[model samples]
Target: MLKHSDIWRAIDRLAHRHGLSASGLAKRGGLDPTTFNKSKRMTPDGKLRWPSTESIAKVLEATGSSFTDFVAMTGEEGDGTGGGAGMSAAAMRRVPVIGYAQAGNDGYFDDAGYPAGNGWDELEFPHVADDHAYALEVSGDSMEPVYRDGDIIIVSPAASVRRGDRVVVRTRDGEVMAKQLARQTANRLELVSLNRSHPDRSLPMADVAWIARIMWASQ
Candidate 1:
């Protein structure tokens, strides 16, 4: 059962996960810094003032947080670390993990890009509301500087894709790559290479099999 306290606590957890204060999270969402301040949670008469849905929407969008993540942040309150924020143990799960090289193989993912075949490694990770979330191990210099070899990135196919977000894309020919999304048109997608040594790509939508947003990464 949801309660008023749960909602406020969720907001705090969200801010904590992002290594921000209530005021900082508000600023990041383009709201007044005091929007989530403790004082704002109550009226001058001492009545409870719930957070607006619009505010929640903006913060989620700004943080690139899936609704599932926000929902997971609700329910409990415990001491969370500052700056190096992490989810509670109960919110962690073992997700399918695959190497970047193996990710392009046909037997690994379904047509929609969800993990399918066996032989995948498992990694304990933060709660991603989408059950289809998986991890990919990096292995090359193409995504250097930002994502070096040996790093792991979590991908969420259920999350919304937008310009400026990092993403993993699989082409019809079975080529898989990660890049920052720069632009998207009715027929084309423009991706910015993580490494300057690698040229950016502009691909027709017809060539794309599937694309998923990078929700979390172990840097």
Candidate 2:
């Protein structure tokens, strides 16, 4: 069962883990800065205030944290490092990440390098330049242990996506996927999954939408 104190404690730890203040975390989650403030944690009558489920969900999305992790944050951690102003502004200017499964879909990313629409589920990360940036979420168990479902991956568009690099690719018909780049012959690219349970696949160069080297993951 969820309790008010547990929720507040989790919020505090989350801010610390991300090196953000309560207000900074709230801003990254697309909420009003006061949403996670100490004063907001109580009512005018002095009753303990609980964070709303929607707010919690947004915070989780923004921080790339799971429900289990949030629960584990109940124990107090030390005060997080400061520089909230700089980091918050830097975060706002950085490239955004989205679920990996959505990359190849035509409407998900635009030619201008901006993620299409405001519909993306986002994660807060240290600033990354726009040209070398992209975000993808892990899907399925094919890359398990190394990458898990729901892990947000950061891709460097400026980095050369060569053979042997882990990459995010799109199929001609609009399927997005992540796998290790294998062979790159004249007309095709081969990809392999980390999990041996899945067979390797070869795809024609013409069938790909975009290819970029994966830089890091939140997992």
Alpha-carbon lDDT of model 1: 0.80
Reference-based lDDT, residue 45, model 1: 100
Residue-level lDDT tens digits of model 2 in 100-195: 555656677765334677544344456666554756656567788777654557777677667789987766687776789988877998999777
What tens digits encode model 1's per-residue C-alpha lDDT throughout 1-219?
Answer: 877788878887776565454655676788986787777889999999989999999999977887777776665544333323455577877677677888988888898889997655456666678899988877678998997655678899989999999999999999999999999888999999989999999999999999999998754
Clashing pairs in 2: 99-137, 100-136, 100-137
RMSD of 1: 15.7
Q: Relative to the true structure, how large is the alpha-carbon lDDT of every model?
A: 0.80, 0.69
TM-score of each: 0.60, 0.60
TM-score of 2: 0.60
Q: State the lDDT at 191 in candidate 2.
A: 95
Error of 2 at 45 (Å): 22
